[model samples]
Target chain A: MAVLDRDTINAVREGFTRHRLSWIDTLPFLFAALMYFFAARYLPLGTQVMIQVAFALSLDLALGYGGIDSLGHVAFFGMGAYAAGLYALYVSSEPLSGLAVAACIGALTGLVTGPLVLRARGLTVVMLTLAIATMLHELANTSAMKPITGGADGLFGFKIAPVFGMFSFDLYGRTAYWYSLGVVAFVFIICKLVVNSPFGLAVRGMRDNPVRMRMLGVNVTARLVTLYCVSGALAAMAGGLSAQVTKLVGLDSLAFLVSGNALVMLILGGAGRLYGAIVGATVFVALSDRAAAIDPFNWLFAVGGVLILAVRFAPQGIVGLIADWSQRLGWVRR
Target chain B: MAAPALAIEGISKNFGGLRVSRDISLSLPVGARHALIGPNGAGKTTLVNLISGLLQPSSGRIALDGVDITNLAPERRVGLGLARTFQISSLFPSLTVAENVGLAFEARFGLDRRLWGRVRSRPEIVEGTAALLQSLGLLELARKRVADLPYGQRRLVEIALVLALEPKTLLLDEPAAGLAVSDRGALLDLLLRLPEALTILVIEHDMSLVFRLAQRITVLVEGQVMTEGSVADIRADPRVRDVYLGTRSHG
Candidate 1:
């Protein structure tokens, strides 16, 4: 205690605050910016990649950072899609307003499902998430809900107001591309804030050892639920963006494959890194588009091959490689 | 008894037909230094688990500062100024030692749910975490990941984490379970120097450490209290020797 005066303690405390946002964190955004400006012809594909990045980023928060293993995250995504779609049909056609509604619905979906899904761990968590997603998918397809959900045919017919009521969603998808990119950027920043925050540290701590966290008076389950809710909201935002951009909410939005694909993207890019989502989504969407165009019937073969290669070579994700490189470069502080 | 800081009344726990704690009762008054010693399979850890709300007793009530908390969640009990260290060191391995201690410190300030900003931006929590680590001689290890630390330092970090809670009642389950002699000496000194008003219940197999730390010692046999008395009384009790003390190698 004698050695720990005000200055000494402050110095030690200063250690925790050592790593702030660095130039390296902005590299991914810079890449995206370059793509936006230089590769404007591929805006439609770029928009799809951004939406997937947003979705995968949300999954990374829940499964990677929060230690919540959800195999059915598409439930929130589909809910967001429907929230935007239904809002457009019955409420207002404004895209921003619809996206906000979608985000709230995603958060609401999380609040409802987090308690049920987060209470379990490992296989049970997976089953519960998958079950919820399946149930949502079935409900959307049910004829009883056909008038509202569009049943199996998909939800459309509602026109989305232009960006700021100026930039229309053109045939080239220029506006939708930029809009989704903005949403993805927003999601990335949120993840960054959370990762550096006390709440994020607590969530990571709980994920590492929940029993120890409980002993420290941390309501582990409650914190987890909150994280799940946030992740859900973000995932829903991605869904809403998809609906607005594509102008269609399909049964596939809630499909199990979507959740599986999101997980794949996260795993391939690295689960916990914010940039991992960006890298994963961009790579996944690009690969899918090329494979589908080259050989439409067996595009899964290309995805499956890439996934296997990613799993075998870089199990920690592509972002993990960058981290190692940064460390080896002798410039990264931590 | 000056309003005991912790009271366990007729606490009993069973696993199907097997009973781990049987009608056990103990009271630790405020500022009391109490130790519970028992032979292996005597359910010493079970009693600690029951008190800490990790395991529920089939029939018993656990109270902290005179409030019954028989059904409180483990985290709820911790919120009411109860903290504990496990016999085996448990920590967030990937995080730095500062982060581990900082998480506990922030939780005390009800900042665990604040999601918007960086945790280190807060001056109070950072200094509090630093002061706690510095006091424990763990300042140099602040940035090191817990997974890379040696076993001895891990135990010290566990203590740091527990103390960050500023608990009124502390439960140390073999605080020096696997430490070397030098580490054990350090731990003994640390335990002896804890706040005078903090009630402590330490479960240990090391008799010398127990003797130096406990004002009163309770010996348990088969999940039931065999004897409860001052340190001298337990040291001289032949039955305690026959059941527990005699069975283990003396320090």
Candidate 2:
């Protein structure tokens, strides 16, 4: 707790300085590097958790900053997973190129659907997003797509080139883990820069009072649609990372359960605060992994109880609650 | 001949078979201070909405600088140098006062699309916001979130945001509503201090404020123009006294 308090102080100070990275901002990358060097046994799980955190960050930008409440964000994730897998099989074996392809596909999907979907607010938007994701899921499961997507069997049998022609993806998964960490660090920095920019503030303004933002000459809907696409691309990149690291793409990536779990993780960590995604994803994923190992049926109850407690007590998520406490303690102003 | 800053002809609004605003037409040449006053439910807000393009006129032609703008969107109208303040003090509550004003400056500068640079690091936006906050006596509260401000300060912040747009035609919907008696003077001072060349239309119920600020006053009754005259002419008009003013004393 004292460590977190110190980190919070540094984070606030860094926020005011603008564009400069502080120890707190770079701590995740440092921690990931340290873990890779020392706790090598847990690298695979760490990689998975980083990908999940990336997914959470994407949702944070949309639902938290843009006020785009979505229930089918996993559509982009699943699409990216498939796109990455397909690219490796049919187009290229280079992992980085596959990831880029996946990102573009995800962004294209958002660009195509964002206008039609973002026009509605509240539950209608949720329903539309859910419908689109479900449609993709069904299409992937169909017999026509079985040869390509592998149907319920999932897609496998793809090779990823070594990292910079040096680090081969070993059977122990060390290379994959480091690659995932690098991607997460890059995406995190990008998300940080985005939310701190004038464009980002405009998004928040639109979320608060779109009518007023429109009066300020902001193309509110257009801005939101653009944000949605960017978020979609980021989410897809996370999914691509997962597919590349695991060497498999599953239909479950697009399922409502994936979307729901990501949302639960975000809310548990507290939404809006970027680092909340990291905290929530790590805690939720690690806890769920342990809980499922102990008792699969009882795990749901434990997850539900934690979510309830998190919502009731730490409504801002752990990060937000900590920030509030720091403010009360006179450690930070915001 | 120079075009009127704003011109509305035969404007009307209906909601599901019920007419809220009847054929209302008015003109404001450059630098005109026009005030629209009416009793409650007289569609004053609806007319403002129509002019601001928040509501489409059932039938009318609205123009900005002689260009027909009846079909333009609200944001497009804003792009054409038109802006309005809300009666309800619409603002980004979670953001700091400086950030709110900075957003306005960024929008005016067409820098709102910039997604890479940190907003606070931009000298033009920072200096402009500080100057604006200082002008409104809100310099000390610049770093304070809008939600933390008093009601009057929040209203001033709203107007400050509007002013940051450097708009040519400003529509203020009850800018003085909810302000304390003492605060109205500050509000009045702020409005009176604006550049005279900036065209302004105020929708206010405060008669003294209206008379003090407006060069021309238009009174509406049941969505139609009841009278159009100077402040003295409005005070003398018997129909305005009987229908609009009635027994309520002017503040």
Candidate 3:
């Protein structure tokens, strides 16, 4: 975590100095930072929003940049949460170590399964991923692993160390929000750099025409596998963050419902665009939280209706919608 | 003995029971402008695909400069000095014409991973792409997205992309497939003026362009080489007239 913070801050500072950073590029980070700062000061929402955003970004990279539509991403997220929870129970409550264990476990799982899942394209890939996630969910619910995973009860009573041995996590939620925000920011920057690189362009080319990319001598399967593992690591990191802040982990974290919601968030924000992930996560989580506060079961219906409308009318999602409108108004042009 | 730039010996390709290319044998010598002309479905494009490594021939060998490149991938063939332009314009639609050309230069120059740097600002890459675009009469459209270009302009961009690779051997799959008569003439003029070191094998349906550009013409019929000769000989051949030229007489 310390290394991540230093690297992220250094990269951000360098990026700021080197390029004339556009508002669109800087807007999401600023918005996230401001929201976290205010929420830490005024609210008690913990780090749920930050964790959701991180998960959303990971999903966007997988589906958008890597051009693999996954309906089983929550499998990695749940695995990470459980791995972190189990590590905390058996090894240490230190958040950093737990996060590391979670990420490694998630990455390994993705590496093993990614080839099989990625071999199939389009809806078959989606179905296979969904099945994988469901299988994980069921396995997590088994009695054999219940001692560590807690089965139906899930893992509970996990603890987190103070951020960098300085500020302890307290009821004020400052420590939790800042820690998650810092991690999210770090991962976001890394993803941004990767997606903008030549390797990233190759992936985009694959999306446009796989045959052409293959003809270009790109090892298509290997690239997809690498992306899958990275995405899994990021998703796991988000899960670890969630487990640390909430101090509990559940089987539902790996459920298809959770994964489906993340996909919906990605599409609602926009695919291919990184900022779309954050926007989708923010809107989806905030709206769900708000509507659920008013009506639990029916809010999902409203969300579903909105998703349908979004798919039909604004297929590019919110960021795309805004970009289009801005272009029309001559306020900004790409 | 120096082998030809491209040697296609006894090459055959089949789709199901249908033979698209049958035991086709041809050798493109260095600096030669060889044209392959046939009616539609005469296997002209199929032969190009085999030579460019887009499809593997079912039989025989493809050797480049005496080195066998029969099983090499398309990009590897490009690396071995084999570059091709497609029948359809295959430019990156979202990219500017210069950027589209630059990508080909970048690929051939092994600079695909030079991320975090200003690729478009690279002096050599920019200059080379610009020069190629100018040669193809696409200098004005350099900064414009390929999607916005007219079909003729887009075709020019595609040829420029192939030229930017600095290939020793070039395969053009109907370079003037879809263009106005004037644009076709302009393209043929541009082709004639290219550096003589670039050995070219062109598949063209337009007889006037083929007669004007090709040093030698190979007439393909029913997936086999029906005849091969100079333009004047091909024009006078009774078999060539009966099979290919005769069909176009009504038009």
Candidate 4:
């Protein structure tokens, strides 16, 4: 038998606490990348799912960690899509700069609306976020901006330059797939770093008990707003990636359906855990795509059935369930 | 004595038409141990809330260390060396015990806003958290989630959280409310052993613990102060006895 006293047990556990992501954590990313070599025919579909993962991760940061409960996060996503699409069309076709421009616009949008929407909680927050996204959607739909936004016809006259002025975006979408994967990896790394930092801990604290956090000398609202903007920028970059890869930005980018779908993905995969975003997006996108091909009219029924099963069996999300099993098997200690 | 560590002058609060706290005034001198006792709905918690800036007072001012903080936010007041624990054991339930206390240390050092480095890897936070948990005899449970701990242990964590801030003044709301009879002694011992330089305003119903740890006692009734004096005076006061017997079914 092991003579493990409580103090000795705790000390040992603390010594090896996984505060930062390890090389093993990158295995999933490597696996996702490796899949491209085998599934060349499905590269575009995989790229779209990866973009969804990036977007879902952004939402997870705010809705999962920050307890933001925003239903209109796609506003930033849509804004980024349009910004990148328009920039490539009118200003510069540099893919990197397009992402940066989209991120800035998204961050700016978050900065402007965060204070107002975050001031309220629960249903009010959801409603205000929806209103903001709806307003932006309506603005994009207006005929006055038709000359610029394409006015529901969708923005399509854009030619994105080759990646880093080298590898051209090919017909097979191999470059675009790798490009989206790279951005998603970069964003995922940043998110991991953020959630492990002191700021991340404080955000989690706010989610658990804002009153306690306030009494602990935290400027709760300021932190919330800052997080909102950062998440916004990241989500926008994902949108920019989507625009760059698709060569199209449409009204659907800013649609409530997009926001609702991302939220659904977050819940299906789980929220607080970042990997949940990855798993949720991949599973949802892949299943939905396959289901649509199998029976376009009845695809919703398949997706709904899967969601019901996931909610019933793994309400905490796929990551949470995995975490539980790992802990039980002594493979992980959370 | 040193301009009072905390001073509440003519503070009153009203929710709608019902007055919860009315002209309740109290002074806590530097390094003093004061106890506020009252029956249910007597506004002891309300008064504590007003002092801690959780609830806005309709009238009056609260000064901390010669600084008027009546209009300051709760976080700002905490910056001014005011700390408090909730009656309901407010904690980051999903986080581990060490993380909970570490957050307080992070807050005290103004590192709560640091967005770059890993919190657990910081030597200061890790060492500070260990030292704090060791002192509270909770080093063993550091890895356990706050939500998974027993109710009494959660309360101790609450106290540890506040102590990690190292505030000059602490407002404890029902710190000993639901402890087993056996645990109250340890709770009292912990309270008594706190540094003499820290002024504490404890709202407790445990007369034994209060009478032992508190040097001064202030009794309240129906949102108003009934009396204030030394423990002996408070214990001997017939009015205090009458109020206790009428309000308290069990200690």
Candidate 4, pairs of clashing residues: none
* Model 4, docking class: medium
Q: Candidate 1: lDDT of A224? A: 93
lDDT of 4 by residue, A27-68 (tens): 768877788888788999999998999999999999999999
**Which residue window of length 10 is worst by lDDT in model 3 chain B?**
B113-122
lDDT of 3 by residue, A1-334 (tens): 1122333323222221111236766776677567766665433453676788889888888898778989899988998988888888889888887888998988998999998998678999989999998988988888887776888888887677787778899887878877887888877876776665545555555565555444444446767777888889989999988888888888878888889888999889998887788888888887787788899778887788879888998899998898899999999644
lDDT of 1 by residue, A1-334 (tens): 4545777665666556343568976786787778888998888898889899999999999999889999999999999999999999899999999989999999999999899888778899999999999999999999898998998889999899988989888888878877887898789888888888899889889889999988989888899989998999999999999999888999999999999999999988998877788899889999999999999999989999989998998888988887888899986767
- Answer with 1 or 2, whichever has the higher lDDT: 1
Candidate 1 lDDT by residue in tens digits, B36-126:
9999899999998999999988997888999999999999999999999999998999888888899888889889899977887786678
CA lDDT, every model vs. true structure: 0.89, 0.87, 0.78, 0.89
Check candidate 3 and list the clashing pairs: none
Query: Which whole-number lDDT from 0 to 100 does residue B245 have in model 3?
Result: 83
Q: Give TM-score values for chain A, per-prediction.
A: 0.94, 0.92, 0.89, 0.94
Candidate 3 wrongly placed segments (more than 4 Å): A1-20, A33-46, A90-92, A97-121, A131-153, B113-128, B249-251
DockQ, all models: 0.67, 0.48, 0.22, 0.54
TM-score of chain B of 4: 0.97
What's the lDDT for residue A319 in model 1?
86
Candidate 4 deviant stretches above 4 angstroms: A1-19
